[model samples]
Target chain A: MSMFPIIMWILMVVVAFVIYIPVAIKINKTGLKRLGATAHIFTCDPDKDPIK
Target chain B: MSIYLGVFIGYFAIIIISSIVGAKKVETMGDFTTGGNSMGLILGVGTSVATWLSVASVMGVPGNIYSRGVCAITGWIAGWFGGTALMPLIAYKIRRPAVPTRTFPEFIHARYDADKDVSPLQIVAAVIELAGYFVFSFIQVQGFGIVLNRITGLPFVTCCWLFMIILVFTCFGGFQSVARTDTVNAILILIGVIAGAITVVNVAGGMGAIVENFATTTAPAVTGGNPIPAGSLTSTWGVFGASAIMSTFLSNSLGASVAPHWVARFMAPKNAKTGALQMFWVVIFLIPIFICIVIIGMGGKALMPSLPEGVTSDYMFPQLIINYLNPVLGSLALVAICAAAVSTANSMLLHCSTSLIYDIVRNIKFSGGKKATVEDDAKTTKVLRITILVLGVLAVIGAIQQWSFLADGFTYVYGAFGSVFFAMVWLGLYVKKMNRPAAWVSLIVGFILYFYCVTQGAPFGLPTFIVSGGCSVISAIIVMLVTKAPPVECYEAYFSDDPSEATVAAMHRIRRDDV
Candidate 1:
């Protein structure tokens, strides 16, 4: 692979990993809200979300 | 005219369909504003990539490539890369403390509790931000006109009017519609780019032939002969050392670190991790499109080997498309150009309306408390819609003003804001100490400095972006440090180890609303 490709890939992975942890803790603690009825990915109903 | 209209209508139909799909259930303020933040990784990444791949992506950028060679292009990618890289650091990791704000300046206000007396100051900063987006949107109007006339042989004014009407409808659907529209537009752009690249290279014989022709042609003593021919970026840094090269890199990082549309992407993402994932996707998908454009650029260089009189080197792509490329694919590329112009301009329009509605109209009187009364919230939404209408009208006026001067008027006016924002955005975010006094100082100083640089022959043939970026960053950082003001809780989050993990947990905990 070219230098640019290698650089962009490593940058993407490392940065994604770096940003992953704190967000996990925040979501785990307070829970989260689904975007809407169609929100397929991440939605913790406010009523049932942890602590609340 | 009919062919041009056919290409335009096809492109417009795809985007409008997506917008209408997204706008179906957007009933609330949040939904209206952020598409309820539910975009998938592909859509998010595609749209962001597409947004970056504006007229600049094809015509503006590769022109820089052909003229400066590979190194100059890489020099630019360094800054563009900086803007992308900083997303997780500046925004994703440090978002919670900022989640409540509506606009970019709101993030500024939330970050620093500057004196309440300086409300006008914040509005001035916003106006400064609008300057770039406005220039950008108007340029897209010209871009649409150029492609329409060039490809299908339509009247320029007719093309400009259609471009304006399409933008107003695309924007009227708000963020949700805009997102979906951008996704389709991005896809169309990618398809066109790939096809155009393939067709051009094949039609021109082959890559080796293209490069050889470029090297052998016209002006002697140019890169292998021609001045603006297909050489590389060996000269600009030919005499300058490693430090000079690094300075170019830092300037882009600094400049892109603060673009309004980029930061606005922060609010547009589904969640923190999704945002990060989206950034990765953008990088992955975008490389090919850029490579394709550069290939076409090389093909153009190979074909003309030199521009005709009264035409700049940038016209190479358009000239080639009109003369070469299979008719069907060339027509599709023309349509994709429209998509590129519309996608970028629509984002600018979205931000302009948001700024007007949230910052200007939302406040009746902030004499006491920072937040407004419930009644204040009631009318803000309608006001935003009205602002959208007014902005649409103004954009149409700007589009109509595309007289003999063509793009020069728009570029000069709009480029002003990009300089200012790129200068101060980071300090305003990470360096909490930058207060109202410093913010104002950096803004004014950066604006004048940028104008001066652009006006005064742009110095080293380098873009005004570098000078303006350096001055803005320096002014913003220096003032913040002098005052020793750090935004409350700013340091803790910015320096934290893992930011998106919290959202990942929320991702797991989420329940389908069924609403």
Candidate 2:
């Protein structure tokens, strides 16, 4: 209920978002499109599969 | 009883509702295992954080801080946080494999599959994973039982069974259900930590008083028959001393990257970047929660010097909520505590069961020269549910017997997972020479060394993880050089030189090269 505790909680949020959001966004925009292709399901012949 | 009943019923209702909602999205084995590999950043991060913050994070770390010192944060909490930093080393590489694998062991099976058949090494790895996760799940139930026993005055075994039933029912819908419910648990855990911290801070007469007390308060001369050195609260080494703390830090720092439950989360992300980026959000959300737990542990120590004789320090966190906060809020916090345990327990159980059915059983069926059929989606789902039920029952039986082997030595199970898989998986991703023989040798050496060190009481205060993991990696490298290297196709299928489409294609071309 005190202003100090409320201030502490808000500061934690603000600091974390300020640091994280930008990096996340940049990665999403530039890094994601490229990584998306790599993450696509790789089709393979069943007999050639190492684990099959 | 009324407040607790209402809180628990409400919690179960939310979990069931999420299960029903998520069940609609699960139509295939992939969906059942990895949520259809369509999880966006938010859901992926939410579930990751929730699953990672097991009872160890919620109760064990705080209890350690309460009894030992702030170094518990450095050793246990900070170590876990640091583990996420290592995730990028394998995240995109593992996620971008030429083919998607359902379980961590399946990835190992696919990557190190000798002779294009189910590798014996893969089956051994699955067995280890199943055993590790079974103990992990058992501890969750054990933690839950301890709290419920204290609160309800019920026998511990009864409480264990009660939680076992609830956890199994909640996870019956499998990964989708677990993910949706975990998202909810993640939110509640955040709220609970904040609420608990605020209450503790206010009770301790604000942050200034708490800090002053922590700075000035001497650790009790005797804690549960163990002598506590003076001024451990602020000391860097604290009661456990530097070598033990450092060892724990090194071992736990790899916990997230190698643990089967956490590894499964990487497979669910919508894209490679999402898998990599999820670590950032998990750490961001965890930072405040980490700060709050530090306050609770330190602040509680400042206020309540010691528990009555016979009560373990593990009771510190739950007792704070039960005694200090308002009944309604206390009950909510209790739900969060139970949520923490159940959220993690469900995920581990799911991973363990998947390893049993899809990873081990299916491989056996295929190896028996049984002709492979198109896996019937409905049958797979039914078999998976049955597996979940069976594993849950086994976990309940294990939970009833107090395994001091695991419960007392908190770091051993985690150390085993890290020691066994840390070098093998990470090295296998980048080094084309990492063959199945080397992996097998590494795993065997790691297991023997860790258990031998642990049985010898981790002689000279060196941590089991470093000793085992070091020996394992060294032996693996030596073995890889002596044995024939795996064909280039093994490397091509599992890794890309870089996270680019062109590189992926190049890798695949080599993967498909004529034998």
Global lDDT of each model? 0.59, 0.72
Instruction: Please report, as a residue range, the 10-residue window in candidate 1 chain B with the lowest summed lDDT.
Output: B506-515
- State the TM-score for model 2: 0.86
Clashing residue pairs in candidate 2 are none
lDDT, residue B125, candidate 2: 80
Candidates in order, TM-scores: namely: 0.78, 0.86
Per-residue alpha-carbon lDDT of model 1 for B1-515, expressed as tens digits?
A: 45545776677777777777867756655566665555556667767877876776666555554544444344445445555666645445334432334467654543443334235654765675565566667777777777776765678677777788888778877777778788888888888888788887898899888666644444422234335332333333322234444444444544555566666676666555455556655655676777787678667666655556655444556667777876678777776777888888888887887666665544324434334444554456567767766776676667667532222333344345556665456665555465666767767776887778765745675556557666676777777677765533323333333435442322111110111
- Model 2 over residues B1-515: C-alpha lDDT tens digits? 78877887898788778878877788777788898777877787788889867777777777777787777766776667667665644666666664456678777766677345556776888898889889888988878887788778899889998998878876777788888888898888888878888888998899989877776676562355554545667677677777777677767766446776666677787666567667766777788887887788888876787765756677788888877877677777777778888889999888888888877777665563344343554566678888888888888888787574222344667788888887778789878899988988888888888888877767667776778888899999999999998865566655553434543443322222111
- iRMS of candidate 2, one decimal? 9.2
Best by DockQ: 1
Best by lDDT: 2
Deviation (Å) of B18 in candidate 2: 1.0
lDDT (Cα, 0-100) at B337 in candidate 1 = 76
